[model samples]
Target chain A: MNVALRFDPVRLPDHCQDLRQEVRDFLREQVVQGVYDPTARSHGYEDICRFAKAVSERGWIGMAWPREYGGQERSFLERYVVSEEMLVARAPTRRYFVADRQSGPTLIRYASEPIKQRVLPQIIAGEAMFCIGMSEPNSGSDLFAAQAKATKVDGGWRLNGAKIWTTGAQHADYMIGLFRTSQPTRENRRHGLTSFLVDMHADGIKVSPIEMINGVMEFNEVLFDDVFLPDENVIGEIDGAWKQATSELAYERSGPERFLETFGAMRAFLTAVEGTDDTRLQEGLGRLIAQLHTMRRMSVSVAGMLEAGREPVTEASIVKDLGTVWDQALPKELRTLISLMDYDQYDVQAYRERMDFYTRMAPKLTIQGGTTEILRGIVARGLGLR
Target chain B: MALDSDDIHVATAERIFSDRADLQTVAHDRDGAYRASLWQAVEENGLTIAMVPEEAGGVGLTLEEAFSLLRAAGRHAVSVPLAETMLANWALAAAGLEIREGVLVPLVPAPRGHLAIDAEGRVTGVCPEVPFGREAGAFVALCDGPDGPVIALLDPAACRIEEGTALSYEPLDWVHVEGAPAMASAPAGTAAALPEMAATARANQIAGALERMLDATVQYAQDRRAFERPISKFQAVQHLLARLGEECAAAVAAAGSAADTLSRGETGDALLLEVAAAKVRCGEAAEAASGIAHQVHGAIGITREHALHRLTLNALAWREDYGTEAHWALKLGQLVSAGGADALWPLLASR
Candidate 1:
C-alpha cells in the first residue's frame, strides 16, 4: 500500500485492490466511447445501477458472499475498494448498493437457510433488490414500536402496516421488514417485533412514490395491507427481528460511503475554482477536504475492525453519525462554486439534474440505515451509559 | 517528505492511560484533576523524557515517535501538562543543565525584569504568569536580555508563589523569581517561541477536547428524540453539528501540523506564521465547537453529573491559555501587515 494513500488501515484482499484498476478501466472505456457521462453519473438510479450491474457482472456484487451464491468469495476490503471507486467515479450505484452491502449481509447472518439459498444468488447476481422497512410513522425514531402489524394466520402471518420514507422502494423487488408480531403491551412492545422478507409484488402491498424535496421519487411510502407471509419467511427467531436487523445496521452505518457522499461534488467544485487567494471557497474547501480526510481515516479504521471479524458497533455508529452530516454539508458549502463551474460534456440541465438529485437525497442518508439518534444511543450504551 | 515530530499523531500511545470511567470522571470535575494519574502514566511511558538524548538521563526517543504519542493524546483527551514539561526539559537539556523530573511552569516576561548573565553562571529575574506557578516545582523564566527576552530555567525554591488567581482551572499560581541558576540568554524572541510550543500543545489539547465534545454532543442529539424524531434528523441541527465537527477537526490538523513545523525547527517568521495561524484558528474553532456542543446538548449537558462538561471545560480553559484568539490575531496581523497589503500569496508561498 502507498503510505500516502493510507488514511485508515482496513485490509483489502490482494485481488480487491486489482479491482480498482478494473473499475477505472471500465469507466475510462465508457467515457472514451461516450457511453457514460461523468457529469451525469450521480443523477438517475437506473443509470447508476446500470453501471453497478456492469461491475457486478465482473463478480463485484456481493463479492464477499459464498461462492455457492455465485459470489467471488472475496473480502470486505475488495467490496470496499469497488464501492469507494464508484463514489470517486461519481457514478450512481444507489439502486443495488443497499441490497448488496447490508441487506445481503443481514440475510446471510440471520435469515433461514431456505431464504438465504433462495435470495442470496439473485441478490449476488444483481437481479433482486431489497430496501429496508424499519422506519415508519409515529415510530420514525422508535423503530421497534412501528405500527406495522403481523397477525397470526392459518399457515403464516398477515402483515398490515405502512413504512414511510422508504428509499428506492418503487424499484426494489423486496423489503426486509421488521413488523410487530406480538401485541404491544408497553413492556414487550419493543421485544415482540419480528423481521420478514416481504415481496413488494405480493398481494395487498401498495407502493406509492414520495417525491423528495429535489423532486425525485427515489424513495416511497410502502404500505402493507394484509400482506401475507409464509412461516418460512421469518427472519431469525420470533420477535428477535430487532436483534437480527440491528447487526445489519452496524454494517450499514459505518464505512467510507457514509462520509464520502459529496466528494465528487466537492472535487467538481475544487476543479471549478482555481485561485487559492483569500476566497471563502478556498478556505472552506481546504477545511472541508481536511475534515473529509479525517472522517475517511476514522471510517477506514472501522473497516479494519470489521475485516478483523469485529463488528465495531460503537465505532461504526460514531463514523455514520459523523460521516452522513459531513457528507451532506459539502454541497451546501460548495453550491456557489458548483454554480460557477461547468462540465465539459454535460449541458446545464444534465448537470443540474445530477446536483439537484443528490442534494435532495442527501438529507435521508443520515436518517436512513440508522438515525443519528439511534446510533448515539448505541454509542452511549457502548459507553455503559443508561 | 520529512514529517515533523509534532505532525505525526499515532495511536500506540493508547496503552498507558485508562480509557475508562475513572479517567473520564477526573477529566469532568468542575475543575479537572489536572489529570495527575494520567500525567504519572505518561511520564512512565517516556512522554516527559521521551525525546531527551540518552546521555541526559532520559529515554532518548526521537521527536518523530513523541509526536505520534501527542496525536494519540489529542484523540483520547489525555489532559496533563505533557508539552509544557517537554519544552521545559528540552530547553534544560539544550542548555546542558542537569535536571530531575517535576513540573516546569512558564514565566512571561515582567517587562521590568533585567536579564544578567552573572560571572558565576547564575541567571535571575521576576516574570509574570508563570503557568502552574503555585504548583510547579520549577520555572522556565523569560527575562529581558540585551538582545531580547531569553528563557532560563529557575529553581522553584528560588521563587515565591502567590495565592491562587482568577483562572478557570484554578491552576498553580504565578511566581516572583529572584536568583535562579544555569540561565543563558539567546535571541530576542527566543522565549516567544514558548507560546508557539505551548500553543502547539494546548491547541492539540483544545482540538482533542473539541473532538470529544462534538462527538458526545452529536451522539446525544441523535439518540435523544424530540417531536417524534432523532434531533439529528432535523436539517437545521444537522448543519450545526456538522459545522461544529468540521471546526474541531480543522483545529486538530492545523495545530498538529504547526506543531510539526515547529518540531522540525522551521524557525523565524515562517514558523511563527504557521503557529500563529493555528493558534488563532484553534482558539476560534475550540470556542465555537464548545459553545455549539453545549447548545446541541442542551440543559442536560450543563449539569455536573454529565461527562460532556469535562471536554467543554477543558476547551474553554485551553483556548484562553498560551494565547487567545485576539492574541494570535494580533501576532499574525503584525506579520501580514509588515509584509505589505496584497500579501497572502507570498505568505502562502513561503509556507
Candidate 2:
C-alpha cells in the first residue's frame, strides 16, 4: 500500500481573520477584568465557568454544529481559529472544552435526536461539561480492554465498574462513558463495548481525586455502583463503540491544546530573556519557534481537511505525536535556556515558578489523550506495516 | 509515493524524472555521464525557465506550479541544477535581464564572503561553496554594488572555479573572481531577498527528498526479512519508520506553508519568518529522517550500490545549503524576540 501522506497547504479563510480579532478582543477583555491569569497553570472553577458562558454568549462554543442544535453553523476553520486563540491566551476553557471539541461533535453524529436535543443545547450554552470514561485501571491505551460492565436491565443498562484518570470528572456535568456490554468475539477483540451518556450527578457514582505530581487535582478515579443509564442514553450502535471511539480521537488529538499547553511557560521564558544578546539562547528560541510554527501549520492543515469533510486519522495522529512530543520537551528546553541567564537579571523567580509547573505538567502531554507509542502504532498502520 | 495527478505541471515533471532520472540509474552512473541528458530533457521541456514570465521569452508557470516542479526534481534526486537554474531565471526575470538558456546557477554571497561590484560595474569577490557553480554556463550573482544591491549575470569562464562536491556528490564549487565584467546587470529591487528565496527552494527540495526517503525505507522494511518474518513486523522498526513519517510530514507542512506565503506575493518580515521557519524545520527534519532511514536500512544504506544514500545524503547536504538550521534559527529567534512575547501567538496565527 502506497500511503503517501498528504498535508495540503491550507490557508485560513478571510472570515477567520475577523473571527480571530473577535476572539483576541474577547480574551483581552477577560484578562483586563481579572477573570484569570493567562500565565497561570490553572484557573479557578468560577472563572472557568464564567469564561465558558461568556464564550457561549458570543456563539463561539459549538459554532461548527448545526443551527438546530444551538450552534452558529460556522465552518470548522472558524472553530479552529477560536480554539487556538483561547488556548494560546491560556483562557479558562476547561469547563466546556471537552464538550465543544469532542463530546458535542460525537453527540451530533451518534447521539439520538432526543439526547441531542436535550444535552446539546446545554453544552452549546456552556452550562454543561463532559469527561470521558474510556481508561480504567487496566485499559489505559488498550481501550477495548475496558471492564466497565453495563448489564442489561428492564428499562436501561446498569454500569458497575470504575474508570481511572478521568479528567475533570469531579465537576463534570456529564460523561460519555464506555462500558463492556458483552465478551469480545474471536474475530474482533474490539467488539462488545458500548457507549452511554451518563449524568455525573447520578446516584451511586463516586469521584475520588487523583493528585498529580504538580500538586494538581485535575485527574480523578470515578466509581459507579450499579448506576442506571436509560436506553435513550445509548449513543450509536451497541457493541460497536470501537468504531465510534476512533473517529472522536481524530478530533481530540489534533487541536491546538495538544501543543499550546506549555506556551505560557514559553512566553515567560521569552520575557525572562527579553534583552539578552546570547546567541545560544537566541538559536534555541528560534528552533523552538520554528518547530511550534510547523506543528501549528500541520494542525491547521488537519483542521482544514476536517473542514473539507475528510477524515484524516493518520494525519491527525501524526500531528498529535509530533505536537505532543514537542510540547512535552518545550519546558525543559526553556529551563535550560533560562538557566543560562543571571538569576537576578530579570523577573526570573516567576519564570522559574512557571517553568517548574510546566516541567511537572509535561509528562502527561504525551500520555493524556493517547500515548506516543499508540500514536506511532496508528501511523505505522497507516504505513501498512501491520 | 502518490503523485498529485490534478497538478498537470507536477505530473509532467514526474513523468520526465521517472523516465530519465530514476534513482537506480542515476545512482550507478558514477562518472556523471547522465547529467547532460538529464539537464537537456529538463531544459528542452522548458522546466528550467518555468518561473520566468511568458512576456519575457520563457514558459511561465505560476509560483505554485514551479515549486511543485522543484519538489518533483527533489523526489527523483536529480543531480542536475534544476532548482538553481529556475531560481537564477526568476531573479533574471525580476531584473528584466535576458533569461539565458542551459544550466544557469544563482550565487548569493554568504556572511563572510561578500561579493562587491566596483565603480566600473566589475564584480570582484569569491563565492564559496556555490552549488552547481562548476557545471553552470553562467552565474546570476546578487551582489552588493556601490549604489545598492545589483543583480549581475557573470560568465563562468571569468571566474576561477575550484571544484568541490557536497555530501550528495553534487558539484558545489568555490568561484574566485577579480574584476570580472558583468555580462548583464540590474538593480536588485525585490529580488535582493535571494537568501530567503534560496532557503525556501532548499526547504522544498528537502521536503521532497524526505518523502522519497520515507517511501524507500518503508518499502525496504517490508522486503527485508529476519527471524522468519519481515523486519517490518518488528515494533522497533515500525516505530523508526513512524518517526521518519513524522519528520517527513513536518518538513512537508513547513515547506508547503512557505510556498503558500511566497505565492501570495508577500515579502518583508512575513516572508522572512515563514522562510526562516521552513528552512530551520526542514533542515532539522532532514537530519532526523536521514538518520532514521539509515538506521532502518542498516549498513546497506550507506553503500554506494544502494539507492538510499542518494536521497539521504542529498537531504543531509541540503540542510546546509540555504542557511543551515543554526543560521536560520538564530535569525528566527531574533525576529520572535523582537516581536515581543505577546505578539508571538498573533504572529503565528496570522498565517
Candidate 3:
C-alpha cells in the first residue's frame, strides 16, 4: 500500500528552485557584463571559453564530480537542475561541458592517477579543451573500424593515422585517440583496437579544419604521423581499450544538450507571439512542445542514472536517438508551419540563418560521437534485436 | 522546481494501492467493498474534493493533483467508483449543491435524465447508473428547462445502485427519480466543463496505471532472468521498455498540463485535445504497460497468483470505464478534423 499519491513535479524541493535562481543571477550578471549577447548565447555557445572559466569559478563545472579533483560533488538531480537553469538563461555553455559531463568521469574510469591529477585540474579549470577524436572517413557508421594506428616504440608509441571529423581540434591541447594496437586476423578486427591520449603538440601531429555544410570550421581533419606518445601517456590498459572507449562514449552520448539545442528559439517564439489568439499556432506549438517536454524528461532521467553511479548506455542511446529526431524536426516542422502563414514566413527569415545553422550542425549531432545508424545497431544488439 | 503535494499525493496513493491491489489477493472481495474502501480512502484524502473551493470544505487542490492522484489509483488497478465520483461531484456542483454537505453527486458523463432540488430542498430524478447511489447522501443532475439542461440536486435516498454483475468489478448502478426539483447551471462556461470535468479522474487513472505499468515492467525485468542474464539486459526488451517509458512520461506530462489548464478555467477544443490525448495514450499505455510487464513476467504473469493481473485488469477495466480508445479516438479525430484539410497546418505552426 506504499504507492499512495503524495507527490508531484510542481512541488520540487525548495533548494532546487533556489539553485535555479542562483544560476539565473549568474547568467544575468554575465549578460549585464556583456560577456555574451542575446543573439550569440541564445543557442548557449558564444563565449564558450570565458563561460567555462566563469562557471568553473562558481564550481558549477563538474558540479557532480568528486571534490577531490575540484568538483563540487553534487547529486545528479542537482546537476540536472543546474543544466535546466543554464538552459533557461540561454547562456553559452560548450567549454565547461567536457569537464562537467564527460572528462571528469572519463578520467575517473579510464585515466591513470597521473592523468587524472594532471589533466583533470586544468579540465576542471577549463584551461584545456578536448576535441573528441572518434570518427574517420569510412568509419563514420562503424566506429571500431577506425583506421587510426599507433605503433609501439621503445618506451613509447608512435601514433600514425587520420581522424576526419574532430570537433574543437584547433583549440584542444590533447585528443582521446582510438587506434589499432594488436594485429587483427581479419576475423577479430574490432577487438584488436586500443585507445590513447595524444598530445596535439607532438611532432608531425597535424590539425586541419574541415569546413562543414554549415560553413563553420568547428570540425577538423586530424592526422597523426610519427607522433610519439610517452609510455606515461597511456591512459588505459593495452588491448582493453574498447571498454574504456565505450564508457567515455556513453558519457558523450547522453544529456539535455540533445534537445536543448533550439530551446531558446522556442521560448523566444513563445514570448513573441503572446498578443495573438491564433488557433493554428496553438495546435502546432502544443504538439512540438509536448515532444520537447518528453525528450527533456527522458534526458533528465538518464542524467539521474549517471548521477546514481549507473551506466545507462541503453537509456542514453534512446535519448540520443529521440532527441536528434526532435532537434532535426525543429527545422522541418517550422518549414511546414511557415508555409501556412504569411507572418510566420517573414519571421522565419528573421530566424532563418540560425535555423539553417542549427539544421546543418544537427547532422553532426548524431554522427560526431556515434552515428544514428551505428547507435541504433548497438541499441538493437543490446536489446537482442539481432 | 519544488515538487508540490501533488507528487507526494501520487506517491502515497500508488504505494498504498500497489501493496493491496496485487493480482493474487483482490479476488476475495468478490463484491465491491474493496473498491468502496479504496474510493472512500480517495475521498478521505481530499482527492474527491479537489475542485471545490477551500471555503466549500474541501482540500481545494488543483485539477492537476487530481489527474496525477487518479493515475496512481489506476496503477493500483483497484476497480471502484472513484473517477465516477468526480463526474457526480461535478454534476452536484453544477446543480448548486454543497459538495461536502449535500447528497453525493451523479457521475455519468452523458446524463439522459435529470434530478431537481427546489429551494425547499425537495429532490427528484431518474439518473440511471449513478455511481454509489445505494450508499451515498446527495446526487446532482440537470432537469430540462425552457432553455435546455438545468442543474438539479437530488436526494440520494431517491436513487438506487442496481448492480447486476458489472464489468471489471468496480461497482456501477443507476439513480432513478421522478419530478426532481431543478436548479440552474453553476456559472458561465459550466456547459463546456464536461471534457475537463470528465478528464480529471480519468486522467488520474491513466497516470496511476502508467506508473504501475512502468514499475511492474521494471520489476519483471529485474526478477526474470533468461539466457544467463536478466531479460532486461536483452536489447529488444530494453528498447520496448524504453518506448513504454517514453509513453508514460509523455502521458504524465500531458495529463499534468491538461489538469493545470482545466484549473485555470480554460475550456476549448485544445484543452479537450490535451485531455483526450492523455486518455487515449493512458489507455494504450496501460495496456502496453501491462503487456510489456506480463511479457517480462512470462508464464507466472499469466497465472492468477501473480500480482500483475490486478494492474492488467484495472487497465482493461479503466479502458472501458469512461470511454474506450475508440470513443476518445473518435472525439480526437473530430477535433483534429475541425481544422479541415489545412487544420493540421495551423496546429503544426506553433513553433
Compare the candidates by TM-score and give the number of the best one.
2
Determine which window of 10 residues in candidate 1 chain A has minimal summed lDDT.
Answer: A1-10
Residue B138 Cα positional deviation in candidate 1, in Å, after optimal superposition: 14
Question: In order, what fnat does every candidate score?
Answer: 0.00, 0.72, 0.04
lDDT of each: 0.64, 0.88, 0.61
User: Can you write out model 2's per-residue Cα lDDT over A1-386, one digit (the tens) per residue?
Assistant: 16587887788988999989999999999899988887676777898899888988999989999989889889999999999888888788999999999999999999999999999999989999999999999989999889999999999989999999999999999999999999999999999999999999999999999988877799999999999888999999999999998888789888888888888888888887776678888899999999998999899999988988888889999999999999999988887887787776668898888888878778888999999999999999999999
Encode model 1's per-residue lDDT on B138-246: one tens digit a residue: 7665555555445566666766677664333546455665555644434324335665767676776776667567667767877889999888777667656655755
For residues B211-321, could you state the per-residue lDDT of candidate 3 as single tens digits? 666666666676678899887777777766665564555456545655665665666665666556556655665666667667666746656556666666666665654
Q: Which candidate is the best by lDDT?
A: 2
| Tens-place lDDT digits, model 1, residues A95-135 | 67888888888778788888888998888777777888878
lDDT of 2 by residue, B1-351 (tens): 123735787888888888888898888888878777777888899998898889988788777667767777778877789999999999998888889888898988865477888878899998888898988889999899988999999999999999998988788888898999999999988678777878888898898999999999999999999999999999999999999999999998888888878877888777877998899999999999999999988869777788889898888898878678998989888887877787777788888
Q: In candidate 3, residue A12 scores what lDDT?
A: 28
Residue A324 of model 2 has an lDDT of 92
* Cα TM-score of candidate 1: 0.64
- Against the native chain B, each candidate's TM-score is 0.83, 0.96, 0.78
Model 2: per-residue Cα lDDT at residue B91: 92
lDDT of 3 by residue, A1-386 (tens): 22221212232245766786687688889889988765662333447778888887887777777777777777776777777667655676756565567656776767777887888788878777776677887786676777888888999898888997777787677777778887666666567677777778778988899876655667789988889888877767786677676666556676777777766556545443333345565456555554554455456546656755777676677667767767767877765654565664335555555556666666666655566666665554443334
The regions of model 1 sitting more than 4 angstroms off are A1-22, A33-35, A41-49, A151-155, A225-228, A335-362, B1-47, B52-204, B207-285, B288-351
TM-scores, each model vs. reference: 0.64, 0.98, 0.66
What local lDDT score does residue A118 receive in model 1, on the 0 to 100 scale?
Answer: 93
Location of the lowest summed lDDT over 10 successive residues in candidate 3 chain B:
B342-351
